[model samples]
Target: MANALPLVALLVLAGSAALASATTFTVGDSQGWTTGVNYNSWASSKSFAVGDTLVFNYETKAHTVTEVTKSGYDTCSEANKLSDDDSGSTTVTLATPGTHYFICNIPGHCSSGMKFAITVSATRSGGTGTSAGAPRVPAMASVVVAAAAGAAFIKLALL
Candidate 1:
C-alpha cells in the first residue's frame, strides 16, 4: 500500500496534465464579441490548436456565432450554417486542423467586419500536454520520465 502511493500519485498527475488544454481564447478579449472591434486582427495575435477552445462573450443576444463554410464566410451568407448560436456566450472547441470561419449571421453584422477566421494546427502549443496527442513538451516529458523512474525504484524496493 505505502509502496504503491508514489506510483498512484504519478499516474494521477500525468492524467491531469494530459487533460489540460493549450488555450481558451475569449474572443475579442475584453472587448467581448461586438461590433467596431477588429476580430480578425484579434485572431492574428494568437495561435490556435486542436483541442483548444474559443469562448465568445458578448453582452447581448444582438450578436451570433455562426460557423460556416468558406463561401458563406466570404459572402456573409447564413443559408448553410454548420452551427449557429445566439447565446451571449458561445463555446467552441477546435477539434480538427485546417481553417475555420465564423461570422455573425445577423444582417449587416458580418459585412461590418464582425467575422474572423482562424487556422488551427494539428498541434497544441506552449507545452499544454493536451490529450490530443500533441507533441510531448520536453519539460513535461522529463517529468513523466522521472516519475516513471521513481515508480520503478519504489517497486524494486518493495521486492
Candidate 2:
C-alpha cells in the first residue's frame, strides 16, 4: 500500500508535463504576410508541432491565406483550395503532423514568392519515440504508473 503513494505522485508529475502549453507562431514575423517576403526562409527557422498555431497577419483586400494540397502548392494553383481565409488576421491550428502548404491566392502573389510550406515533426519532445508530436516521457510514465498501481492494488487485495 505504501508503494502506491509514490506511483500516484509520479502520475501527477507526468500529467503536468503532458499538459504543457502549445506554441503560437506569428507567420512572417514582424514583416507580416505580404509579397516579396521570403517565406521559405522564415518557415525553415522554426519547428511546428500539432497543437501550435500559425497566425497570418495581412491586408484583407490585398491578400488572402489559402491552405492547399501538395499538388496545388507545387503548381501554385488556387483552383481547388482546401481552405481559404481573407480575414487579414487569420489563425490556423496545426491539428495534424504532416507537411502543410499555404499560399497567397492573389493573382500573382504566389508566383511573387508569397507561398510557404511547413513540415510538422511527429514529436515535439525530440527523440526516437513514437508519440508523434507529443511528449513521450509523460506517456511512458503514465503506463509505468498504471502498471505499478495495479500491481500494488493486487498485492493489497491478496493481503
> lDDT tens digits, residues 86-159, model 2?
98999898889999999998889998899999998655655321212332233456666676778778888879
Candidate 1 ranges with C-alpha deviation above 4 Å: 1-11, 125-159
lDDT by candidate, in order shown: 0.80, 0.79
- Report the alpha-carbon TM-score of model 2 versus the true structure: 0.68
> How much is 66 displaced in model 2, in angstroms?
0.3
lDDT of 1: 0.80
lDDT of 2 at 103: 95
Predicted candidate 1 versus true structure: per-residue lDDT over 1-159, tens digit per residue: 456657666776776565454567788877888999998988887778887788898866799999999999999997888999998999998899999999998899999999999999897655542222443333556766776677788778879
